[model samples]
Target: MASHLFVSSTRSFSCLSLILKPSPPLLGVKTLFSRSTRFPRTYKPLVRHGSNAHPKLLSALSSAPPVVAWKSSELSSARDDVVILGIETSCDDTAAAVVRGNGEILSQMVSSQADLLSRYGGVAPKMAEEAHSLVIDEVVQRALDNANLSGNDLSAVAVTIGPGLSLCLRVGVQKARKLAGRFNLPIVNVHHMEAHALVARLIERDLQFPFLALLISGGHNLLILAHELGHYLQLGTTIDDAIGEAYDKTARWLGLDMGKGGGPALEELALEGDANSINFSIPMRQHKDCNFSYAGLKTQVRVVMESKNISIENNPISSANSEDRRLRADIAASFQRVAVLHLEERCQRAIDWAIKIEPSIKHMVVSGGVASNKHVRARLRHVVETNDLQLICPPPSLCTDNGVMIAWTGIEHFLSGRFDPPPPADEPDDAMFELRPRWPLGEEYPKGKSEARSVKRARVHPSLTSMIQGSFQQQL
Candidate 1:
């Protein structure tokens, strides 16, 4: 690691004061402080072991590395010309994008690990990390190139720091720090789930805070109330696996194509069969809380598949005979129905609870990889509309894991002066960075649990019950 100089100062200043160490031949750069440590009001002496009382100062020094000095003016919160490059390697996707402060998407790029996912059945952390290391550079460069700009043109670098795989998060963080250092740009650390929720504001310019958001993906299912920038109250979360993971596992059990991801393939297959065919129970029916549980539903599908003698081996859709294919399709359709129904149920309760807390809430943003599903969007739309709230779902491309959301979320934080100074250009490869593999979006709502218990569970639609009984009897 590169040696770092520690500066101790108790005085406050309106701007940054930095001392530069001259390169080899020129020892001419004099220290601002005299040999006796006499210095100006804003200047402080260098210390080998400083007082541990200055945590903020220490954090700034340790996390951001060293070298370049940033003035307070440079950290202005209202710079309208701010352009950020957002980098996301939270999971299997390596994505990068350029987004203007005004929500203009200059360029975006994603290098997916669909092949790896298909081969391994899911994301293998070690393999996923290696894959990210290989393509992250190329993807970021492409994003910059397509934006008709270079790293130096960017005002700041925004990257997802947590709520994802630590190894994958590190790949993006290191690349971001390296770029920010090279370009002398500020850095903004982002929470992965917050990025998913805040990106809606980018698409819907009128999307104000105090709105409800249901973020669904392979690893997370969250219902949060966005109180304001950097302030949120989580209303619901997954007690078990996320909806996207359930979708992938269901697709695999049905022998659907694993290419292009299991969610899309399963959605397409569901389109061909009766959605009410299997009657798998919606998860968390007995519980009136917004918390989700897809694990049981996944098990239900496995049981029904086994009862029908469907092999769990790698049986592709193409190899299945006509009857087998239809049976699989029925299972797919039914599984998707219950999975989404669970989401719908949770969202309805969340909205009810949210509105009581923030009656001004008028829009509900549904985002994440699973939000790309037309069925999921449609179902959630009804729930939002019934509560007199407009539903805002980003375009299909933005719904999935991508760099644009990171870039956009970065813009939100940049405007609030929440960012770090650029690191040293020669920041070592082993330099430690802040990485959060399990960061929460925000704090849990204090009344969320109490309010949930008071909310009555709506009756399951009669048609759904009848369909469930019919499907179960037929299978037996």
Candidate 2:
């Protein structure tokens, strides 16, 4: 059942930098904006409205600043580039991309799932997986065609490994392995969440680590430090439904279509919302580990709807004229405000830790579909300024589930010499070609606290510990 929808579901080469200088090498790291100089005016002034308490934004995230900085170095203009291929199937979309390591996208394609689940309301994993099974081959063909390259033209293949629906993941992984086996293509098992962290590099190559990365998507809400390339230390994770899930469920309750979903639609409505009109307090105000809980917020939304006797799953939110639009906007605004606050609170702790070593992390990159929210963008920008952390989010297209991110991640794995013996594409067809419900991007890379595995697998490589520093050194 899953493999059937899997076909419908949609869904990297990287540069390898060989170190020339041994010790604390001085690469002319590009200058990154400390924060957006001007406020993004996409949303009307909500803070100026009648509200007693301020959002408190990132006040606590700014303890140590970047004043104590890296030893400066003189550098040269760079021209060398990497070409990579990325494939994403962490959930319902079949996507693929070709990106230049220099931060330019050559080609990207997504076969969406909105039409498949429109009647059903919400996604059924089995149906989604089946969709993947049916359409993935064509999707890959389309991506490769769009890139003006065949599979043989790819340096490596990057496939999302986990932090997703197991059924959907299988179709992508299985296809990736088939390609790797047939082409002897180096395969990098990519982490859906980590890919969110690394895309910032494709855009802001000089982005420093020991900085906070908020990966808010359908399956996860992680607070992490990209201490180095390939390495990610999870400081905090979601204790409940992910921020994306909250947005999706809420969208469903509001009768938004599967095509629009929650995140994108909500963002559109929020433009007309009065964030202060709907009073929802921040959740997990008391948790200490930087861990987040979005389930409570989801429940709260449900409760509010129930109390108002508003229909969910059937009766979508109906705002017809300007007045109704205002109500939709208000709901969206309040929800966005709540989500942003939750992230801001947890990220504060992560930033505090980064400052202990680097003084200030140069960029506070927020990725994932929800990061595309204009209000979230606005709130986060303000937070970055208040805490002295630079706010960076990939362009909305890159922020969502796309092939460019996958291809870029694959390139990173390739440069790091991480390869796995993938399942042969020409092998006898059987369960071997079938999807596995389990795949881990970093599980085998390291164990316990600090131990990393030396042996390699077909999936995610590039020692995750690299996140602790810039393992992705600039040779430019």
TM-score of 1: 0.79
Question: Per-residue lDDT of 364-475 in model 2, one digit per residue for the tens?
Answer: 8899888887777887788677888788899987888888888887766543334344445576544453232333223221111212212223443343343223333432
> What C-alpha lDDT, on a 0 to 100 scale, does residue 374 get in candidate 1?
92
Candidate 2 regions exceeding 4 Å error are 1-82, 101-104, 318-329, 421-425, 431-476
RMSD to native for every prediction? 15.4, 14.9
Cα-based RMSD of candidate 2: 14.9
lDDT string for model 1 (1-476, tens) is 11111111121111121221212211111111111111111111122233322333333333432222334343232233457889999998889988876677777888888888888888889999999998888888878777777764676799988778889999999999999888667778888888888899999988887789999999999899887766678888877689999999988888777777999999999998888888788877777778888888999999999999999887788898989999998999999888988888889889889989999999999999999999988888888888889999999888998899999988776544345667899999999877767666656666555332232224312221132234334433
lDDT, model 2: 0.62
What lDDT is obtained when candidate 1 is compared to the true structure? 0.74
Score every model by TM-score: 0.79, 0.73
Please report how far candidate 2 places residue 318 from its true position, in Å: 4.3
- The model with the greatest TM-score is 1
